[model samples]
Target: MSWMPPDLPSAARARLEAARVLVVGLGGLGAHVALLLARSGVGHLVLADADRVEAANLSRQPYFPEHVGRLKAVALGELLQRIRPQMGVTLVPQFVAPDALPRLAAGCTAVVEAVDDAATKAALVEAAVAAGFRVVSASGIGGVGAGLAVRRLGRLVVVGDECTPCAGATPPLAPRVTAAAALQADVVVGWIVGNDSGTED
Candidate 1:
């Protein structure tokens, strides 16, 4: 017998089989969410990220040290394929736009907002909501003082918080990034299992 719940309905099982999810950003949160979703049997994943992995990303990000000069989406795509050879994973190495939201959100059952920029996350949330897609986003997931949170925003849940920016607007640590990513995946899986343990924001 499979490890999945025996009591789950065929429809719920089918939901997993036919599920279409979009995960934006491939840094910390996005990487973790994509890995978990692939492992959880999500059928189709649309990954969007314009950034490439850096030598500094090896500590908390999912990619190996050798993957440092590669586009994040491509590197993660390879990893996802290795995780689930049968799953459909598409990597778009371009920044998603509000105009593209309709097409991207089309046929998608849910969208996970793992982007780091405040303006970008807000834009994605607005567009996804307008496109009628359920969304989960990250809030406060950076800083030496940071931690994870699961907050519900209607049918959506925002993970933690924004990444800490340097005076030159650069990211600092990896621990909080990984924590936030795990929380984002937790919310997504909770939704898959028909539970929303969001902190009720």
Candidate 2:
């Protein structure tokens, strides 16, 4: 518990602990974002990711060497619980299909979109907006030093360069990925704490 940050005081902590958040995609972005929200005291987390961990994923992801070949959602759900014993975590070992979006997002305080695919990111933002929940998403997050920025579009907050394609020459590195994830997590926490900044980063 000493490793955890100072508490948010009883009142604000209660508000945060009562919130439920759905984090899509357990890759470089989602994995770190989920952990951050948990550490920030978000009570219930719905983690969705169908992919299994591969050796290559360990480079930037939060997985251990032994975690390779394990289902990402399952592995992370277990770890997040160890970080916050009283937290409620639901693991969806399957991909977040369009039909399942509403059910998964219904009561969530916010949806954090951390998927690599551009189309999937767009779909998540759309669904979260339609369901009347704010979304924190990313774009052009592959390279380092492109610089990170926050852009608001209605109920959506996007972080990243806004132009560096993940499929571009530069592959995803940890510094930028975790930095962006931190920014995303901060936005989610800000919304829950009722001090969300609407300005650019």
Task: Name the top lDDT candidate.
Answer: 2
Model 1 misplaced regions, further than 4 Å: 1-11, 145-147, 161-172
Q: Superpose all Cα atoms of candidate 1 onto the true structure and report the RMSD in Å to 1 decimal.
A: 3.0
Task: Report the lDDT tens digits of candidate 2 across residue range 115-171.
Answer: 887787788778778878899998888766777888888789998888855454668
Pairs in clash, predicted candidate 2? 140-164
Clash count per candidate:
8, 1
- After best superposition, candidate 1 residue 119: deviation in angstroms? 1.4
* Candidate 1 lDDT score relative to the true structure: 0.79
Best candidate per TM-score, number?
2
